[model samples]
Target: MIIDLARFVEKERPYWQELEKALDEIRARLLDLSDLKQSRRVLGLFQRACSDLARVGQANAEPELRNYLETLVARGYSEIHSSQTYVRRFRPLHWFLRTLPRTFRRQMWAFNLSVALTLIGMLVGGILLVADPDGRQVALAPFPHVAHQTPSQRVADEETANNDKQKMLEERKSSFSAQLMANNIGVSIKAMAFGLTWGIGTALLLFYNGVILGAVCLDYMLDGQTVFLLGWLLPHGSFEIPAILIGGQAGFVLARALIGWGTRDGMRTRLRMIVPDLATLIGGVALMLVWAGIIEAFFSQYHAPVLPYWLKITFGSIELVILVAFYWYCGRKTGPEEEAEQ
Candidate 1:
């Protein structure tokens, strides 16, 4: 079998070079064969290398060429057998901006359920509070500040408190921030943890939150404090409320994992699968709460004189819209990942 050495080398050189480039990229963690097209391409190249190696041996091709192909084939074999998992350095920005949103979108059904439950609770609480004004004691018992004083009176007290109220607010801001963060974080975690109860506990927690929120808002609205309500709550409430809902979303994800909704995987397997998602959600919620906490203590507490209601409302509205867009579009695959699978 007379092999045309020059012709064979020319024909196979491109494939060999291509395989080498792929291997390098994989080593540097620049390319991922998790994409089916890429994976098949690598696999095909590996087979071709094996076939070429056999021909090289039979034809007694130059030892230098044979050694190069051998090394290339070996690299491809290791990669194909067990794709290297290049652990990325933990990046807070990437996690917050990309991973969190991606995970949120993946578990959006659960998030929708959470929002629905909260809305229902809000409606129920609002109706009850409006229908039975005497039930303020029972309905608003959880919030003594709003419950004890009329909305107008509370507004008066907050707006009038302190010599140079700005200085007073700044002075106590740290303590207030810590307290708010602690309280909100506690509530959010409890909501997520309640997923152990097949989501019933989670649903009830969100609902209770909604009820309190609804009652407070309705009381303010009825007392003709809608502007004050929006100005005060909108700033921090925008981030704080959604953070809690995401917490509830995380709970529902856990509940689905526990219940094994559509998947046939075992309970442990299912739970194990969602560990990353749970962590991402909890982390995202914590960050949002931190922002809310700071805003609540420093910014939300201010009234018309200190921070204009329009400015505050606009800021909060911007934050809410950005948050919504982030979840809807961030980290979505629209590139070659959308290419037809191999």
Candidate 2:
């Protein structure tokens, strides 16, 4: 049977056009080809284009039609074969702005639960301190100097005069910042690693952190320095807290995989599946903690009292807003590939 080359070209032109459009969108960064649906479509289109190129050759189609099919197939092939990861294009910035938020949003349930657990610990610690002042020592165990003395007593002591305090703070600023950064990183790494224990360690860490914070707040409140403490903690804690919570969420992801006992997928397979999201969470937490360390060491202590209390609080609030906006709105826009995937 003689093949109707002219009729075939006419019929398949739409498919060729679709393939070209898909390629254009993907190359232009309008589409996210990572979504399974969109990725499948792209592959299918590329295959069809390849088949059409072969058909044109077999039919001995006119030069114009053959060249058109050849070009379409070439473009589709290049795009489909090239690296498709979001990181392949924009690198770190892309991961931070788009991938981090997307991963966080996907694991919001774990995050919310972590937050709830932390809040409970804070409340319990605060209530215990109020109910029995002796419990303050337990709550403030993490802070040696502040644990034994009231904030007022510490402020008024001869050895800890304002000038001496300022001098000591200024001298230790760099070391303190480094220490804080190291501690934050340690906490995050532990929170992620402890998922091997089925999340018990992570949960305990979150609670302990909250209790520490609550006890510190109680210390300041009893000394009538609530505003002062807020100024000190809010600036860095705004970022630090979220980073820690994200770590907790990451741990939960691993814990979930480990507990996949009844599921069709084995624990190891589940672990591999969540590797991308876990990496993103851990990386984002590290970046946030770095920023927190800077603010805590250099800015928070200096500005907490120098700036008006209201202004400091406002700045912290603004930072919190920025964090929320970054996670909620960043990378929400769908490119052509993403839209097709949906």
Candidate 3:
């Protein structure tokens, strides 16, 4: 029996070990049974164990047994701990939010490109607006039309501007915190979606936004309203532009992932690996949008002529610092995990 057991262990170690454990337990139980019955039960148990060991040995002798073992091990691990199962259960949106900053950081090149492009767009737009024949009309379109002017009319106009500003402030007070978050998230999603079109769509989206900004700046410059434009745009553009650039970065990442999907191991395998990265990118965009909305709703409407430039500069600088720090922290946190996975 000892020799047979040794042979079974050599031929089928996994099955032999399991059978040995069961036999040990049966041996312990048999101590309580009558001698005849214990002998009969021991024989039956030995026969069953031998059958199990033979079945496993035959299976292992088949071609591709290594592959089969790997599959079995993976399946067993998945059944026990279910790491892959848990990842599957994970909601994309939730993952997108959680990993957003890391995704944005990974796409820093694209973000920088978007920033440069946005600045160029603003410059070009400003020039176009300045050269436009109806520059004043275009710039002041946000205001209402009125032909005649009186002392009372001027006061009324001033009051209306104050009222608009106040209303904007109230709205900001109510929703400023959430707006930036929502806007950042939306922009990131848009970037990712556009990336599906092979990044051309993303480029166009960036260009269109750039053109709009440039036209607005040009209009202000042409009207000799440089100071006004600077005051208005500086407060919010500081945060907003960076947020948008981050969005562009997300788009670039998505495009890159999509393009690289099938050139190596095939699409399914690549996508499984990249799912986490994709989530990170989406989260980054969401964060940017939230910041953008806050700036737009709260800081953009400040029209005080006497507001200090230093104050604006200081606040903007601080916000930029915070944003940079956030990305840095996220990078440190997720970078190693991603690298290890790679």
Best by TM-score: 1
**Each model's total of backbone clashes:** 0, 7, 17
Tell me the tens digit of each residue's lDDT in model 1 across 4-47: 98999999999989989998887777888778999799888889
Model 1: residues with Cα > 4 Å off, grouped in runs: 1-86, 164-168, 333-342
Q: Please, what is the whole-model Cα lDDT of each candidate in the order they appear?
A: 0.88, 0.83, 0.57
* Alpha-carbon RMSD of each model: 9.5, 9.9, 12.1
Model 3 stretches astray by more than 4 angstroms: 1-103, 116-120, 130-160, 163-184, 261-265, 305-309, 325-342
lDDT of 3 at 4: 48
Q: Worst 10-residue stretch by lDDT in candidate 2?
A: 152-161
* Best-first order by lDDT: 1, 2, 3
Residue 94 lDDT, candidate 3, scale 0-100 = 38
lDDT of 2: 0.83
Q: In model 2, how large is the Cα lDDT of residue 271?
A: 83
Per-residue lDDT of model 3, residues 41-121, tens digit only:
544545554464345455554435444444444433333333433433445563443355556665577777667766776
Better of 2 and 3 by lDDT: 2
Provide the lDDT at 84 for model 2: 52
Tens-place lDDT per residue, model 2, 1-342, is 336977887788888888888889988878777889998988898898888778778877688978988888888777777645532655787788888999999989889978987998888888878887578877877788888777876644622347777789889988899999999988899999997899999899888888887778876887898777777678888999999999999998888888884469976788888888898999999999998998888877764335666777777788899999999999998779767756
